[model samples]
Target: MNPVATWRRLLAEFAGTALLVTAVVGSGVMATTLSPDDVGLQLLENSVATAFALGALILTFGPVSGAHFNPVVSAADWFLGRRAGTGLTAGDLGGYALAQTLGAIAGSILANLMFDLAAVDFSGRDRSAGHLWLGEVVATAGLILLIFALARSGRSAVAPAAVGAYIGAAYWFTSSTSFANPAVTIGRAFTDTFAGIAPASVPGFVVAQLVGLAAGAALTLALYPGVGQAADEVVVAHDGGTAPTHAGRP
Candidate 1:
């Protein structure tokens, strides 16, 4: 890719991640206000909104930056494609991760401000349990496995809807509500709403997610030994030469 294309891809990653966080945090606030009496209803509403938004974002941005709003996805792409030379390089990985993380923080603040909340109110919702950690591991691992599997099997075209659907289902099935993305976990800590995670709990979630990343990579390799050949097409192929980013799920 040209220098201009690099910048463009970076911009797409930033904007896509920012909007994804906005949807997650914003919808949580809306769900609470709309259904204050029922936690289950709030979760359902939030999950539905997030699923739709995530799929849309992937479709919109996948052509530019692979829509990889999650650091783990980028890392996975690099690791898997290192031998094949088809995924993100080390420098590109760093840039993508930084952009995604900054975008996520901005998104959290945007969502809070839109809902009349403080700009940077750290969440107090404690989610520091062993079971929750286990859930995170499961959620993140499953997510990685799904995306890579789609790539390896030449089915990445359906990743947008498939990834969204998997996340929505994971929300109900996982104990930690499937906060599989480290960027998202950090962003959610900035708001004390229905979807926020406490700042103190962010570390554990991130660690679990990393663990999940490893597990997912192992599973994918075992299932599809030739997955490395499709590393550049993890989520979906893009116009640019680089591998497209994965969906920035919360």
Candidate 2:
């Protein structure tokens, strides 16, 4: 890709990630504020807002940056490009990852500001444990399998809805509330609110997500053999630039 186009894509990733974390943290604060005593109610509110916000964001940004607000998704896209030779370059991967992480942090800060809180307080909620890690693995693995499988099966068009629905469901089913994206996990650490995770816990979640990424890659091969995106389809790049053919699922 040309330098200009690379920067364009990175900008999209950054903006998309910022908006996503804004939704996550903002809605979390809203939910907790509205339902201070009812954990279930808070989860319900957060999940609904997240699902709707995610679906809208994907549709809005997919064309620009593959909507890959998640670092693992970028990694997966890069790995596929390396193997199949039709996706992101290494530079693109690194840039996208960095943009997404920074965007997420910005989003978190924005959320805090909106809610009249300290903008950069670290979370105290310790989410480290075998169960939480297992949940992360399960949540991330399912996300990978769902996204790539959709791309392989020529269903990337439905990813906006499908991916959102999956994450919403995963929120309730998974123990860790489906912090499937490493960038989001890191971003969540910046806020000590209902949606926040302690900085200490971010590394563990990131590691589990990576392990899940590997597992999902293996599963994609075993389950959907020889699934490649069609030429007419693109994951991101609103300018009609080509990105790896995958579900621009974040």
Candidate 3:
């Protein structure tokens, strides 16, 4: 890949993540402030809206950046062989992760400003280890399963929609409110906005997400043996042409 392309992809990731977090956190703030007596209903509305918006954003920007708005998704793509070896380099991961974190923080700050909900407690009252762990497992599993199903079926064209829908559903089904992205989880700690998590609780959420990611990856491989090989070969062939040396996934 050209250096220019790499830079463009990174920038796209930054933009996509920023937009995604903004939609999610921003809507949460709006729903909480505007709802009269149905906070749950408001959150549900916000969740679905965020899902559709995020899907649109991914479809609009995926071609440019692989639409990796989350580090876990990027890492999963690398493992599934969708990303070229050079594309998943340490530098690339660092850039993407940093961009995602910063974007999420910016989005949270914006949400705070928009609602004047900055002083609200962001942490969920129940932070039990078992509850958090279960939330992470369910949320991450749902996300990875959606991604794997779409990509493996050659329906990469609709991956964004599938992922978005999964996230929206996960919010209601899971206990942790569907924080499947580690970067976003950490970034939410900085603000005490509608979507913010306490900084003290960020590490636990992150660890849960990582564990969930690992479990999801393992399950995907077990369920779809050899599916990743073709993807790896394609990435290898693509990177072989004028790109730097690195190992492809699978």
lDDT, candidate 1, 22-62, per-residue tens: 99999999999999999999999999999999999999888
TM per prediction: 0.94, 0.91, 0.82
The top-ranked prediction according to lDDT is 1
Could you tally the backbone clashes for each prediction? 6, 4, 0
Worst 10 residues of 1 by lDDT: 241-250
Candidate 3 ranges beyond 4 A from true positions: 1-4, 82-87, 116-128, 229-250
Please give, for residues 72-188, the per-residue lDDT of candidate 3 as tens digits: 866765666543342355566678788878777776666667666663346553344779768987798768766755555445656666778888888888888888998788667
Q: What lDDT score belongs to each candidate, Candidate 1 first?
A: 0.88, 0.82, 0.68
- Rank order by lDDT, top first? 1, 2, 3
User: By summed lDDT, which 10 consecutive residues of candidate 3 come out lowest?
Assistant: 232-241
| Model 2 poorest 10 in a row by lDDT | 228-237
**Could you tell me the lDDT of residue 232 within candidate 2?**
21
Top of the candidates by TM-score? 1
- Candidate 2 accuracy as lDDT: 0.82
Off by over 4 Å in 2: 1-4, 228-250
